[model samples]
Target: MTTDLVERVRHRLAGESRGTDPIALAEAVRAEAGGALSHDAVLAAVRQARDEFVGAGPLAPLLEDDTITDVLVTAPDEVWTDGPLGLSQTTIRFPDEDAVRRLAQRLALAAGRRLDDAQPYVDGWLPARQGRIRVHAVLPPIAANGTCLSLRVLRPVTHDLAALQAHGCIDATALSILQAILKHRLAFLVTGGTGAGKTTLLSALLGAVAPTERIVCVEDAGELRPTHPQFVSLVARPANVEGAGAVELPELVRQALRMRPDRLVVGEVRGAEVCSLLNAMNTGHDGGACPLTELIRVFLQVRRVAASFPCHAFSG
Candidate 1:
């Protein structure tokens, strides 16, 4: 299909039956742009229109691919994906940079965030219908090049200790050690870099907790999925453009403290929330867990170890 035809179809379809009926809309668009497009190209054009205006546009297919763990849009012509085999580029492309910008802005809005020149970047977790994507979008001033959208596919992988062992996320020795940590009620942190299976590992460990134990998890994006029956989760919320309502992790940590939690879980420690979490730990909130990005900095502040501790930390 020609660009002119696609544009014409998009313009006409922007009304009443745009996304509600893709099939009928596609048929109508194909008829409207007839004679010029080849028989095979007509169907392609139809599907393209459906993808463009009706759905997530170019990103629906990528999001549907279970193997793809991430989708990176560096530019309109440049799209990359990271799967089990690792990062690689794909053939997905938009008409221009503006299309990418529109898609990014729509995703942010769909997730109840505001993104524009005033706020060049946004960070939030999409609803389940949007594939539960963790979104971080940047515009020209902050991005240098153009609009860039980074989406992390948070697939449901709340595995148990044995499942982690089966998937090689942890060796048998590590699994045994992790179970011992839970059994003994030792307070420890999961120190690892991004995409290092830190959240996956921590979720598995939380699953091993006793059913009777009450666990509360505070996160920026609600990434952790614990199998424990009594798991309670709280996610941070960003303030609007007016800057009236904003809820941070530290406040959630304080809120979780008064709820009589047997164990507390923080998805990541980024700021004063760490101080509150540490204070709670010192006050005997044992078996708490958090992913510390800078493993070195965390250890540098640990002045001493237990006189006769039974567990050792694992680093990878």
Candidate 2:
């Protein structure tokens, strides 16, 4: 099919159709052409339109692939993905930089964020029925190139310690040490570089805790999916465009302290919440797991027998 025909159908739909239903779209396609479009053309137009209206536009198929762990967009023509085999380029390309910017803005809006020149970056999550996507997008000047979009895909599968060991994320010796840490209710921290499976290891460790113990998790984006029976999670909220009704991690940590959490888990410690979390663990919130990046200096100041595990493995 020609691009002009698709463009015509899209223009018609923009005026007539507000929904992405294939049947309605097909009817509109045929009606816009006065019943001239063939079945193949109509089907093609509907599929393309549906893709545009649905999740992640052209990147929806890649997101749906369970094997893919990360998807990156550096330019309209440069797209990369990370899977079990590792980072590799794919054939997917955007129509232009404007198309890439449009998709980024749309996704940011879906995540209840703003992505424009004034606020050129957004860190948020796109929640799905089966999995969640952590979206980090930056505009040109901040990105130092074109618009850069990074997506970290977290599927809804619980990785226990055994699963981690099986996947080579941790050896049997490391698994035993982790089990003993939980058994003794030792407060521990996991640190690593970007995409180093810190969150995955933390989730698995929390999943190993006793079912009766209450586990409360606080995160900027709700990405942790542990398979424990007793689990509670609190997610931070960004301020609206008017800069009102913002909830940060420190406040959430203070609230979690009152909830009688046997294991208070901080998904990632980045700022002021470090004080609140230290107070919690100091006062007797044993069996705590904190995952962070380049925040060990803060942990060093607090005198505690907490174990620090640096995760370097990347298992998709």
**TM-score (all chains, Cα) for each model:** 0.83, 0.83
CA deviation > 4 Å runs, candidate 1 = 1-19, 27-42, 129-131, 298-316
What clash pairs does model 1 have?
Answer: none
Cα lDDT of model 2 by residue, 57-134, tens digit: 888878989899899999989999999999999999886787788789889999888999999999888987558889
lDDT score, candidate 1, position 255: 97
> Which residue pairs come into collision in candidate 2?
none
Write one digit per residue (lDDT tens) for candidate 1, span 5-49.
666776676654455365766666766776666767777877776
Best candidate, lDDT? 2
* lDDT of all predictions: 0.79, 0.81
